[model samples]
Target: MRLIIISGLSGSGKSVALNTLEDTGFDCIDNLPVDLLGAFGRHITELGEDAANQRYAVGIDARNQPEALARFPSILDGLRELGIHCEIVFLDADDQTLLTRFSETRRRHPLSDRDTSLSEAIQRERLLLEPLHERADLTVDTTRTTVHQLRDLVRERMVRAPFELSLSFESFGYKHGLPPDADFVFDARCLPNPHWEPELRQLTGRDEPVQAYLDQQPAIAEYFEQVRTFLANWIPSFQRENRSYLTVAIGCTGGQHRSVYLAERLGEHFRAERGPISIRHRELV
Candidate 1:
């Protein structure tokens, strides 16, 4: 059984993250009293090691009283002896993000009910878990992530080791903004503004009329041809380095027109040649 121990500070998104792991196929047990970890592993194996995909996620954190910290290492050791591949994932956030989230939601900090301020409690908690945080296989900072972005970051890790990295494409508007999680960003606004053409106003880059119109413009065609070449050249370097995921963003005046088309074309290029990719029109959606 591959046992994944999900532990971190009080408000680091562990509960939601564990839920994501469960959604992706892990047998997740939240706040499993930390003490029962050893027995659970042994029982799973005895019932036929291969019988039930022996994968589990356990959430234990600062919300528990202090003594639980002392018991953590020993429990992990017990799991190791049983031939279980145990790994810990630690989630964290900046003090500011934590404070903002709690304040916005009208929820008091878990350790703040003792008359201690949230900021003070956060500082104390960070210092206490310094050791465990160092040992974590993965550490995620949720200071500026949306729910979907956070889920993607966590979901990519949930795939088994040696998993194929996937490419993602998104389209954005210069006004509404670029995608924050993009690894590669392109300002397609420089190429052409399809919003100006009366006939092309309702069509996007994905539509034949818009694409044909853009194709007639030497600069637009030239730009995309170059971008395609660039991606083809660099993608395999990423593959050779074993990067798990890559995101490319295309932006125009409005996400509805040119950027949307280019993102679709880019997705087509990735599917045609690269191993795998997930494409999205961020603003269009």
Candidate 2:
């Protein structure tokens, strides 16, 4: 069986690296324990000589400061004894990049908790996993790479993977503010408010009737045209940039009227001119 092991220092791109294998139809096992590694291979090996078709991708990280998990080399040797083949894909960025990620998200490092400072824990964990990194079959540097870029790298390596690119377009009410992880954000509230009309109060933008009503507003139509042009320019650019997904959020008051209509239109336009598009109305439904 084709066994892919995604490993790296804590805060490296291990989670993202598995995307390629997952896309390629490998049965992915994330954050598997070190001791269970051999059993996994034994289970897969039982499938017989044709076991080559049955593949696995496992993710291992430094959770719980897994000092004991560093036995990966010995595990690899064990798997070697079993007549199994494996690839160790390691991901790493610089310490500074990881530190910035921690700062930007305001998230505690996995190696450390409230009990310890981030820098110390990161150092401690780095010292632990340094050896396995030296044996990596593939190493990716994610310091300058965006998430989409990282995802694209995985796709490029996984030749037999399926087409798993799912596009999600969302419409949200901006009054509450933008979604934290928006790939592309646009302000549709600048367009005319369809909420002023009592006739359109309950209808959502996904409905043809609501789209028809919003289209009657001349300014909204103009705004849609300009935004459509921008989207057309950006969608290809995003794909060329190797993004796995893009989220475009359109917003207006109540999210039931203008935002909804605009999001629906964007989804349609994107699907027609670009790749497959998945849409979500965050607030307007």
Candidate 3:
């Protein structure tokens, strides 16, 4: 059976992910008690091939007992031993984002009470969910994402074929901080800066003029070739190890220039050889 365990902070779009999976025909159950996960899998296992072929998505949150949440890793191991294909997708957002979301929605956090403030509840939830977060096959940061965008991301990244490795190339500005989910981070600030030109400053790496300017730089060419070569050599090793998702983050002084150019180029280069590839610019959108 293919089982996807969705878990994250209370306001981090976990429900959006589960709803998207359900729309894609997954048999989804939300807020399932952690202790019943093993029994549920065994019950489905005895249901035979038809049941096994049906995709399953379950939502797990910090509402469960602390002891049960702590045993998540072992429970996953047990599921794998039972011949089930299980994967975890952990959704997260920055503390400010979570706080804003809760304030806007006026929804009490699952772990929040009269004694606990929303900020404290958010921090405590993160600590409780650390085990699952560490073992996640994919971690999505929705700090700046809209609900519609989150739904599309879940559909593109999770609802596709099983066992196929999905690769994402993200571009970000050093000013905005690194993407917390990136597996490999490459620095492109050493390359020529397109932001210096007044005309190109208003444009992005996706613009033809900006692309042409970056392409003309000898240093840019060398940097792109080296980064591409390194990833080309190492990506397959990760695939061979059964890694289902990989995020390669490229950063520059500002995400609009060199980093975006390199991420676009790399995504194009690998999309031909790799089956599923996605590109995102953190500062632009």
Candidate 4:
């Protein structure tokens, strides 16, 4: 049986991840206590080749008792010894983003009360979930991701063939913040600035004018080739290490032109060479 544990901070889209997994045919349980992990694994093992119950996903979080959460590693060891395939997918977002999400939704923090502020609750939750975070096989940072984007990402990753290293090329702006999930980040600000051109100012890298402008720049070409070469040389190493996901982020001043163009270019270049590729332009989305 295959088991995926979904654990993360509140407001970081754990629910969305779990739902996406369910939509993709995983039998999902939410807010499962950490202490029950072993029992759950054993129970699934006892199910014995029930095709409908072969894949399982459970959501675990800070709501569990601290002592129980601390026993996760040992429980996971026992589960693996039972020949169950286990993977942990941890989701996180920045403190400011979490605060904004809570404010926008008018929802109280899970760990907050009259004595604790929301920020404090977030910090406390972070500390409580550090062990799970440390053991995560995949970590997704959703500070700039919309609900739909998060859903799509979770769905795509969950449905990949076994042992495939899925690749994501994301574009962002330095003005916003770095994508916390990126394994590699490249800066495109030094390239030609299309935001300066009056006609091109309103257009994005996906637009022909912007693409043409960036295409003519010698520096951009060199940068793309070098980055591509670097990835080509190193990606095999990650695949050999059995990595399941890899994210490459490119950032410019505003995530409008250069970064988007480069990310798209990289995605197109790698699509033929790689198994599954996802290209996201953060500001555009």
Candidate 5:
């Protein structure tokens, strides 16, 4: 049987993930106590082949006793010993984002008390959940994501068949910030700057004009080839290690031209060779 453990900070969209999994035909149980995990797995196992074939998603959170949470890793190890295919999907957002969500929704923080401030509760939650985070097979940062976007991402990336790695290529501007979920980051600032050319300044890498300009540069081609070669050589290792997702970020000074162009190129190249690949331009509308 396939088991997905959904755990995350309180406001990081764990409910959304569980709901998505439920919609995708997973037997989902929210706020399942950590101690019951093994018994639940065994119960499902006894349900026979048809029941075993149905995916199971259980939501776990910081609300569990600290001792139970700490024992989670061992519990998971035991599940694997029983021949269950288990994967953990951890969802997280920055403190500020969580705070904002609470404020906007007028919802009390789960870990907060009369004396503990919201920020303090958030910090405490993070500390308590560190062990689970460290052991997660996939960690998603939902700081800037909307409800719909988070749903889409979880559905696309986490609901796949076991051991299928979903690859994502993200383009971003270094001036903005690094993507928190990127497994590997490549700098493209040294490449030719399309922002310098008066005509190409306004055009993006996705444009034919910018593509034509970048295509003429030998350095751009060389960089693409090198990055492609590196990923080709190493991606199988990640898959063999049973990684469920890989995010590759390419960044330049501005995300408009060079980064966007290269990310699209890499995404296209890999999508043809690899099974599932997605591209996103962070700074682009």
Candidate 6:
């Protein structure tokens, strides 16, 4: 059986992720207590061969007792011993982002009460959930992610072929801060600036004019080739290690042009020789 444990901060889109998984045919349970995780796994195991092919996902959070939360690692080990393919997906966002979300929705934080302020509760929750965060197979930062984007990402990462790896290339602007979930980040800021040319200033890397402009730069070709070759050599190592996803981020002064171009180029080159490949332009979104 395939079991996924989703745990994260309250406003980090864990509900969206669980709903997406449920929509994709997973048997999802929300707010499952940590202490019952082992029993749940065993119960599923006893369901026999018919249940072996089923997919299960559960949400775990800081609402459980601190002692029980600390025992999560052992409980997870016991479940794996029962022959379950278990994976944890942890989501988080910066404090300011979480605070903004809570403020916008006018919702109370789960750990907050009359005695505790929202900021204090957020930090407390983070401390309480640190054990699970440490053991998570994937850590997703949703600071700049939208609800729709989060859903698509969850579906792409968890609903795909179990044995295949999903690769993604993301383009962002340095001024907007780095992508929190990127496994590898490359800087394209040193490349020639198309923004200086009035004709190409208004166009993006996806546009033919900007593409033509960038295609003429020798440095761009060299950078693309080097990055492509490096990933080509290392991708197999990750596959052998049974990694489910790999994110490569490229950044420039502004994400509209250079970074987007390299990301698209890399995605195109690798799509022909890989499993599942996705390209994301963060700023353009």
Best by TM-score: 3
Q: TM-score for candidate 1, please give it.
A: 0.58
**Which prediction has the highest lDDT against the true structure?**
6
Q: What is the TM-score of candidate 3?
A: 0.97
- Indicate whether candidate 5 or candidate 6 has the larger TM-score: 6
For model 4, how does the per-residue alpha-carbon lDDT over 144-214 read when each residue is reduced to its tens digit?
A: 78999999988767667566788899999999888877899999999989999999999999999999998
- lDDT against true structure, model 3: 0.90
Candidate 3: pairs in clash: none
In order of appearance, the predictions have TM-scores of 0.58, 0.53, 0.97, 0.91, 0.93, 0.94
In model 1, residue pairs whose N, Cα or C atoms come closer than 3 Å (at least 3 residues apart or on different chains), thus clashing, are: 205-261, 206-261
10 residues in a row with least lDDT, candidate 2: 157-166
For residues 52-108, write the lDDT of model 2, one tens digit per residue.
667778987676245556677788888968877676667777788888888988877
Candidate 2 — which pairs collide?
Answer: 24-161, 167-278
Tell me the tens digit of each residue's lDDT in model 5 across 173-201.
99988888789999999999989999989
Error of 3 at 69 (Å): 0.5
lDDT of model 1, residue 43? 78
Residue 149, candidate 1: C-alpha displacement in angstroms: 9.7
lDDT of the candidates, in the order given? 0.74, 0.70, 0.90, 0.90, 0.90, 0.91
Candidate 2 at residue 265, lDDT?
A: 83
Model 5: lowest-lDDT 10 consecutive positions: 45-54
**lDDT tens digits, residues 117-228, model 3?**
9999999999999989989999999997899889978876787666777889999999899998899999888888988999999999999999999889999988889989
